[model samples]
Target: MQNSATIASDFAELPATASRGPLRIEYRWINDAAADTRADTRIAVFLHEGLGSIAMWRDWPQALCERLGMRGLVYSRPGYGLSTPRAHGVKWPVDFMAHQACDVLPALLDALDIDMPARQRTWLIGHSDGGSIALLYAARHAGALAGAVTIAPHVFVEDISVQSIAQTKQLYETTDLRNKLGRYHADVDSAFYGWNDIWLNPAFRQWSIVGELAAIREPLLAIQGHDDNYGTMAQIDTIAQHVPHARLVKLDACGHSPHRDVPDKLNDAIAAFIASQT
Candidate 1:
């Protein structure tokens, strides 16, 4: 196994073989120290939050991959970062997360030539909406996944989520949140409204993947912050009930994003969990 010292970045174009049409995905690969000892088979994929892009993830994926000595992939979804923007007047559906989990993510892996065999050694590390997507994908594609680590994931809609989302929509209109997020997105509105609009939709309140999570059979680690404003302990707690083998960790004083709030502790916990599984 060769350990490199460079981070590779590029774009993968998906031909319109699926219903979502053609898309360009911007991705970054952190390969420095990727193949440590006999751990070359291990691969980590980082999925960002609802409004996150490759730029927004910054260096946390790289930091975690360095800690584990594994190759890591981080990418922007269709309507985020430098990837294709949402078409004008297109409103996201209530099941947008499902479409992302079922369609977009699989296509991305395929386009990158990550076959099912390789997926057996792949770990999906996701946060917020991305965390939910990771669970949804693992629910149906357990055979293709080694395991999953969800940070502040939601299995069901809650009143708290609605309130936060509503506040965010207001911030986007009345404040400089749009300009600030523009630093990470080529089309800020595409990334923001696409996620914000869907979450605030009245129909989305009924969207729940709690029942679907029972399909996940791989090792799972569910982590959440004790003081998260968007969702509460019920999120990760529900995951533990369905996935009896899932390990749970609640970080005190940590908010919605544990990686940002407590990077060192989070990294150690994840590395230990993966080591124990192996």
Candidate 2:
């Protein structure tokens, strides 16, 4: 099976005129199984970071999907990459992640004709903002997920995280970060500001999903780097404390991106966790 990221890159390498959808939501199949394959096979969905898109994931999703013998789906959220751009002047609400978890994701699945069984066994692999979104989804739609792997998820805002985000704002305004992000986002401002404004809002500082997590009964694997600049280990630690069967893995010499920073270890850990759930 090719990783979903590699498939996405190949799609991106195609002519710009290639039509996907209104939002250019490119959905690719990673496994070569027949369409009528048994539902017992796991399907992993890749959710990108705050600044990520389907293209930014490189070959990691594909590799992980193959390693786990699972089908994979990767898509750029609205306003990112080939996805449809958000309307001008539209701002994300404070509970944007909640909306994604409660609404957008389910709709996306429905559109793709992916039905959730009474006891579904799918996995969610989410990074950064996507990780938080995954947690919210798992909390509300517990029957839809068998396990989840979150890398560098933020449960609450920390002083360090705020400071780092402030620095990012400076970089976006005064440095090449904006130009760099433009490569992945059609509306860079929408993607950046939507995430930034929400996290920086005063009311958002009180945003914590620990209560929701406490209600999650599914297995979870929370991985974080000890040296992550954007968030602290406390994020995953908090998940472990709240979610009944949550497992925490702290990676050394890693940063906010465990899949990118420690691919082999991260993949092994995720594969093992998924296998145990099966």
Best by lDDT: 1
Error of 2 at 29 (Å): 3.0
Worst 10 residues of 1 by lDDT: 1-10
lDDT of 1 by residue, 82-161 (tens): 88899858998877888889888898999988887778999999999999999999998869989999999989998998
In candidate 1, residue 167 scores what lDDT?
A: 96
In order of appearance, the predictions have TM-scores of: 0.94, 0.88
Give the TM-score (vs. native) of candidate 2. 0.88
Q: What are the lDDT scores of the predictions, listed in order?
A: 0.88, 0.78
Give candidate 1's whole-model lDDT: 0.88
How many clashing residue pairs appear in each of the predictions shown?
Answer: 0, 2
Q: On a 0 to 100 scale, what is the lDDT of residue 60 in model 2?
A: 86
Candidate 1, residue 97: how far the Cα is off, in Å: 1.2
The true-versus-predicted C-alpha distance at residue 122 of model 2, in Å, is: 1.0
RMSD of each: 2.7, 5.0
